[model samples]
Target: MLHRSLPIRASLLLAALCLSTPAWSADPIHKETVALTAGKAAHSVKGQIKGYATAEYTLTGKAGQTLSVKLKTNQPSNYFNIRQAGQDEALFIGSTSGNTYQATLPADGEYTVQVYLMRNAARRNAVANYRLEMGLRD
Candidate 1:
């Protein structure tokens, strides 16, 4: 009876060894960049997003990659409305005031980052001078 039980224990150990082997892991995506110029507008820049807005030059990303977005502005105005592929993700909004705005991208795909002036009682159409930076992480 002991000899028969010995074979059963050996088989269980062998099965556990096979299951313990590690599987392959996928690689992480690399960092990328996009640029935006002045003089691009949507319907209007009111409470939602008003006045002239500009978007990034490129919007290509890898699968399963984390995208870190940063927006640097010169002056403190209503510089808001940074979207991912024409969607209102809002990376930065509601008065950053000559500062940098940051956000993270969820998935790998084509994403568009936009910046615009906020339209309110002040109602001034000033030229937008800004820069965008994107990075990747695990």
Candidate 2:
């Protein structure tokens, strides 16, 4: 009888724990291709984001070429991450570092620049308007 009661108590505790945990409301991620001018090495794009929504821009790059990214945003919590085509983790984190990132690409492939607001701002439904500038050169 005691064992049965213990199991019930454990189940209730588990349920409470699950309910107590805060859940994030998922928002759809926006996608776009970074199109540069036919004879240009850089391009800039303007966009808006809010909540948990994200904007991802895909661009092609080559190894040994310099990749530069600058994100200008209306909100301080807004940031971006750069990830190689097949990677799970970001190669650059804008939140920890600043909003500008420049590196010599490691491989020749597609890269994604993801823009979003921090959780603190996202949860508040704050909006951010931004301009993302990207360039690649030798």
Candidate 3:
């Protein structure tokens, strides 16, 4: 009787294990760094220019997983915009005096960030260089 009961217990344990979610199956965290450079041609006829110092990053995660993004700019601008891939929309657009920006992602996928300089001609001439620090948060 004891031996016969051992087989039933083993079968039950196997079933439970099969039904359990796999810990390793969860999506892995990803990150990448990108450099941006703007030249004189990027400026307008009046020498006023506003463009992005962009960075490209690939994100991989489960369908329902949440993604967080943070960005640090070299300098504050009059306005800025954040664009995502496959969506004809802007994630964020507004004025910022601070150098850092943050946002929560809607889904799991690859995203591209473009940090534009919103300074006017006078401000543009004041800036000859800039840097953007971008990252993803789990």
C-alpha TM-scores of all predictions: 0.44, 0.78, 0.40
lDDT of 2 by residue, 10-120 (tens): 999999988774665357799999854323657999999988899999988888878899999889999999999888888999999889998998998899999999999
Candidate 1: residue 105 Cα off by (Å): 2.9
Locate the minimum summed-lDDT window of 10 residues in model 2: 34-43
Question: Tens-digit lDDT track for model 3 on 81-114?
Answer: 5555678976665354344455556765555544
Ranking by lDDT: 2, 1, 3
Between prediction 1 and prediction 3, the one with superior lDDT is 1
Q: Which segments of candidate 3 are over 4 A away from where they belong?
A: 1-75, 78-80, 94-99, 122-128
Candidates 2 and 3 compared: the better one by lDDT is 2
Assess each prediction's global lDDT (C-alpha) against the native.
Answer: 0.47, 0.89, 0.44
lDDT (Cα, tens digit) per residue for candidate 1, span 33-113: 443222222112112222343343345655454555455655455353444565555544536533343345555556654
lDDT of 3 at 95: 50
- The TM-score of candidate 1 is 0.44
